[model samples]
Target chain A: MSQNRWAQQTLWGWGRYPRVESLVARPERRKEVLDALADRQGDPVLAFGLGRCYGDAALLREGRVVLTRRLDRMLAFDPETGWLRCEAGVSLEEILHTFVPRGFFPPVVPGTQFVTVGGAIACDIHGKNHHVDGSFADHIRRVELLVADGRVVTCGPDEEPELFWATVGGMGLTGLILSCELQLARIDNPYIEMESIRVENLEQFFEVSAESGHFTHTVSWLDCVTTGKATGRGIFMRGRHAPAGTTGGLSLLSRLGRAAPALINFPVDGPDWMLNQATIKAFNEVYFRKHPKGQVNSIVHYEPFFFPLDAVRNWNRMYGNRGFLQYQFVVPPDPSHKAIRLVLEEITRSGLGSFLAVIKEFGERQHGGISFPAPGPMIALDFGIAGQPLFDLLDRLDRIVLDAGGRIYLGKDSRVPRHVFEQMFPELPKWKAVRDAWDPGHVFQSELGRRLGLSGGQR
Target chain B: MSVLILGATSRIAHELAHRYAENGQSVFVAARDADEAARVAADVGVRTEGTCASGRFDATDFAGHAAFLDSVRETVGPIEVAILAFGDMGDQHASEGDFEAARHVIDVNYTAAVSICELLAASMTERAAGSIVGIASVAGDRGRQSNYIYGSAKGAFALYLQGLRNRLFKSGVHVMTVKLGFVDTRMTYGLKTGIPIAAPDAVSRAIFDAQRGRSDVFYYPHFWRGIMSVVKAIPEAAFKRLSL
Candidate 1:
């Protein structure tokens, strides 16, 4: 175990921000996982899976990062119960590919299916259906956690409540999540009964969203580029799984026979100056006009409806090497929707419009100490980094969010200040208590954990 | 239809087994590690809900190869498809110093593979059916000083596959030799290279398609053919001088 060689490499979050130099180990089996952990000595080690975290949650600076991607294997599953026990490194994309056509689907999937089950658990990712079915971790039955003491602890909601909740959104600081038992949802078919509604202004966007609460999945693409009367106009889309024996759009005989268009990729990172405010505004205008004023109903494959961005592989490369920030923050529901309006107004005043803006409502909040979703509307926008000016804009937006009693989603933020993070997650100490109990020496730590003061004993 | 995957615990073989099982074929997983093979079998079984079984079979054990194949035949009936996906890339540096180490690498990659393939070929010739695909390596296309021993062994196996394909052609048995590129598996886990590494599942898909189409030889990534062609075309003097 001590003889295992750890290679030095550079790693960054999905946003490509704050690239960290670390000693990396990619283990293909459980024994090798132990080898990597045993050879860690006193340095912190974090299990990195697929690295879908938009921030630094999966990175460890100058520490060992055990790459879990190679450890992917389906261990066990019960067809009748629909309980799948798989290694933590298995990506949701693989699961969907293998299971969806077979009539089973993950209960919840984030915007992109590239994320690993462990990453989904670490961040407690919420999806469009989050307003109804809750976050991804809600479907997890149990987890096999490799704690700092070289012991595998099986924890669940009922088995070890404290450890379970703490590790749920603990940001890999608790320990390395080795494997998990996830409950796969039984679906009628692979098709979705979808509707696209063109929204006009922020007030109407809220109204339409509240009205469409009955739908299983709902999300809106807000055009932040627009100002004046069309301040927050965008397209509001909602969908539910297509019911049995009913073809909403596809002919009954030709079900699932639709040919998929060739996948387009960025190939390489585009120039940083490509996505200026003018170009974004123009694209947004054309996108908005394409959808009709009223609702348009159709039956669509789950692929396009759930993971549109996934179709374009290496879509993140479009942001270039300098990197970009996906500033995502959630504001608790205010009937007036003041926080959202204020944030949009600030962006408009600053003469900046994000490249991509998404708005989704989070339903019931599950009580995890650092879980981001909490029965509110969370808006995420991609902002090209312009150094201090971009940081200043985000800082101002943070204050507005704080005043509105909202918090930024740490999972998507690469540059949120420590003070702001502490304020946002006041229950950090409670989570730390459980973490300290399991990892007393802070063996399981990452760049995100270090930067946010998530653990004790800084030295 | 029944499919037998040797070295079932390997990512590529596991996926090939999965592909066959999901298509409603009886799948038998065989590997050096019995417990690991059974575990892989059970995982595929759940996904496909097909007849799946596992047994212990080591590729290096020349004497025990017949008995292992018999056990699989007894359990899963006639194997319509058989994939040889096992190979050991022993430390090239050590192999250079030790003849025993070099022999072991050759034995596992070439000798063991032939030992199994010949037995399967004999039975398939009698039945006048089956597709046998051996996952060889692009490393075999041209030997480099860094890994010449392993490359030469794989080079031998690919040639063996080509000759076997010709012999089996008269018996209506399709034979495929896959010259795999840098795949994301245990073999290429941490080795640094600029070439794009192919995923195990993607490689499995290509092999599966190749067998079904009765293609004799094809590169997993397809582009590897072009790369390997250039390598083979290089003058031996120049190739040795430029040590890759």
Candidate 2:
């Protein structure tokens, strides 16, 4: 059947990138996706698992895009070992529903469970638990890849090491991913033992976040508007799963069940114009007020603990017709103070306000150099592309990132200049070497790849 | 296209710059004060230079009207499309109470625009391909007791634009008079009225649309078309009694 571009406008986790192209093919099976990829005529092929990559990383411009949503199905689960195997299209939401009842949960999640297994592997996505559990790559046991030659290869840390590493954070450039076997973490209950704290300024925020390093998960929202005394005033939320007896009457299984339907498997778009600055300010006030200063919340379920923002539908439209570009990058951990401060100052001076601004500390060693995650302090933001100043503002930001020994996240960028990107990610040659081996014809491509001048050169 | 905008400090003028810039067109924003115009240009991301600063354009300086037109033409170069977003919504009470105040509105709205249009229309007729847009108002449809002094000036400008449209139509140049309703701008901030307010973006979109399509006249909101029709049809005595 022909694909429906209108229906597949957005993937689960990544934001939307409009396609003026004709059809969007939804494949129910891995073979169908592979066949579609194999049969395409010279057009670029992009495998979209769950469109969760923040920007246009998964977007296939004027090309044949394979939608992996219908390929979702659970294949195996080992209750004792917390080992589970599922189709590439299977969502974290689905895994949470099936395993949380049996006392198992994903080791890491990027704020939301609405992303596909294939997507998580493709971007090597990290979550609040990234410092402790690494990324989705750490938990992934093995994955089956359907190469450009239509050959299905099973790869992991021990087998086909190059392809395994390449596919870990390859942005699905290597080939079409079929299924993945991920090792889950053991949890006593579905509820999380959460703690919330209020930070006064940029200095306090860094100290508080570093202090929370002892915890399993930590993240903070910094208000870039205020300067000098009041800069970075916001909330810091940290949490770990609750243990057996400590989480009573919380009905962990019931909470997971209710959350499963509303959250776990698939996420729909939020209502239009639902995230304006006024509304966001109101929400921030309420959120800050509700959580008392330096208070530990006793019981928090899967929904509130993970997917709080997904309660509404079609949230992206709130950015208006101009859409939005999510910008995220990590500054070197050594010069953390200077690097992070410069980033905030750049944003503030640009006079651009972001509805979603997040700052987190990282310990994960640099992956393939070009890969986004590194041992540094990472800051992420989303900006609307409506006005004239935004383009120039982003251009100014690119220079700051380069000067600070930082690199933009490929998975969440739509505007990084081609020259700047090449300079920042020097490990492209290595990734390109692996990409050449798996798909010698260089059939796989994405809008982001072309935009960054990656797909144009030799495989 | 080389476009020169008068009163380029207004929000609608800024939006005009955006529209032209996005389409890869060159624009020059001109204001009464060079510094103010330059600032507006910087904010709107357009090329700005001053030709009419120093309040030398006393529109009532009817003696220097011809010289003012010649100066603008000489400084800005041969403009392809001339947009007049000039004119003040003067204090209605002041205009009603003092004859000098009433004349101030007239000189700016009608006299200056007419003198400029005469010079511009002749140039456009010679070029035989330019467009001139004069922004009038719906208040000109029928004089309201609250703002008759200002409305009468707009009414005169509206008629002048119509005559220019008719004459220029033969010369292959288009003339447009936009009858704007209440716009949510700095100009209308203090007016305690419940009129449907259109954003400057919306107004700019209308102006560009009419310019591209070369329509002779436009009502900014378009709904004001049907509204003013009923308004004009109303009898004057009854209309005056109905506080609108």
Candidate 3:
């Protein structure tokens, strides 16, 4: 059967920055996806699982983007083992909606539930429990990858291990992921026994996080505007799954109550100056004082704990029309405090505080050669795209990250020099080799791959 | 129950097929575009636990209607409901000048539909139970100067469906005629009809409800019924004088 023709569209990542026009085809069937890959006669095509990457990793400027959303389907599930096999386009939220009541959940989920299984694997996203469960790739048992030669190969840790690992964090540049088998975790209930601790500075954050090792999940929200005596004053939170037979489980009413009432979206992008340091500092002061000084424990629904920002529909629009840049980088466990403090000091001195600053500890690294996480502390800061000064500050931060033996997450990066990217991920050469072995023609290329010089010399 | 959706590649028909498949009903999609039919079948198959199949069906091929129905029955079991949803609203201006164009429009919207309905009616009569749905258009109620050719074809289809319903009423087989208005579909892609277009999914939902209720003849979006009534009530002298 002849594949459907492509429609030209102007596409952007979740950040809504750096828009690119591309030829896109939405193939509804597995055969059409295969046929599209086989009969590639245009610029290299990248399988866009969902537009949730927050960066250019899923974009293909003036190229083809094969949309995989229509290919979503749950092929099989094993209730006993909590094992699930589904097409790549299936979102994490879909899985949760289907299996949460059945006492099962995806082992690792990112901040946003809008991510697809394929996007999760490509980014190798991590959750708050990264200090325990590692990244999304750790729970993936196998993947059916459609490579450049029109062949569907089953890849796992043992079978085609190199291809599997390369494709795990390969950012859709290795090939199109057809479907995958994931091992889900069994949750006793849909509630979390959470503890929130108010910390004064970065030092207290480490102490509280160290004491939270036994907890299933741990993360912190830092107030970036504070400096001097209170350099990273914020709230630290830890949580564990509530046991079954708990008083308040995740019933429909409780779930609805936990969800924000009538989600309010920022209808339009306000003036660029609306999110200046003055406004953010004021908001941070109120936010910081809102939490009590001592530890507060509560049994809360997992929705608010896992995805607080998701409550608001278009929260990203708060960053204004230019959109925002999320700068997320991880520094090695050794000298992590000094490195993080230095990064924070730079932000404070610049007087451009991010409204949303998050910090989490990563566990041991996985076998995915290009995976982002390591045994370190990862910080993510969102800065509205003001102008060149913001880019300049980020470039300076990149040097600090590189010197501290750290790397930035490609899934959240829209602008990083190719040389810096190479220095960050040392396994790129090996990943590129594996990618070339499978796709010698480099039929699966993306804008991010080209920007990072990972498009198999096509640039 | 299994549904046989002829011209399943049409936007409205495809949406209806998905609705049926999602409800765990087996669906067989028949369309002239082989790739589209197969894609829709696979998509619907994954959505439902029930079975789905696709086959080549050219609506204009009058000789192939009987064979196609037989093949569908052999492959997908008896059709509990059959939707005749294929039609072409040819270029009215071109049709006025060309006999072939006018004939093509009539054959697709009327003659071909009549052929398929006859075959389905006979099969359903033998089974003693089934529903046959004909998707005619609201333009059939009263013709205007702009699109009389297409409207006339739909008008003829609507009359044929009325007779079919009367003939099959005693056989326990329900025949439904749907008069759709201003549907947003690929067929009306570039034409600015100056009316609020209805979504195919919404129209499909209405069709499903009407079929379940065994409605004989209903206008999709319901409000179209009142509008077409007013249109049909206009005197021919005044209707022909005003450009619609």
lDDT, model 3, position A123: 88
Off by over 4 Å in 1: A1-8, A41-43, A225-230, A248-263, A289-294, A455-459, B98-100, B114-132, B138-144, B155-181, B194-196, B209-242
Please state every model's RMSD to the true fold in angstroms: 3.8, 25.1, 5.0
Q: After superposition, how far is residue A120 of candidate 2 from its true place, in Å?
A: 0.5
- Report the poorest 10 consecutive residues by lDDT, candidate 2 chain B: B46-55
Per-residue CA lDDT of candidate 3, range A96-131, in tens?
Answer: 877787788889988888889999998888999998
Model 2 residue A110 lDDT score: 80
lDDT of 1 by residue, B29-74 (tens): 9888787788788778866777789999888899999998898899
- CAPRI level of candidate 2: incorrect
C-alpha root-mean-square deviation, candidate 3? 5.0
| Stretches of candidate 3 exceeding 4 Å from the true structure | A1-3, A38-40, A247-263, A456-459, B1-80, B83-129, B134-162, B170-172, B177-204, B215-244
Looking at model 1, give its docking quality level: acceptable
Model 1: how far residue B218 lies from native, Å: 5.7
> Each candidate's DockQ score against the native complex?
0.39, 0.01, 0.17
lDDT of 3 at A183: 93
The candidate maximizing DockQ is 1
lDDT of prediction 2: 0.73
Predicted candidate 2: what Cα RMSD to the true structure? 25.1
Per residue, candidate 2 scores C-alpha lDDT tens digits across A320-371 of: 5556778888877663477667766777777666678888887765456356
Of the true interface contacts, each candidate retains a share of: 0.35, 0.00, 0.06
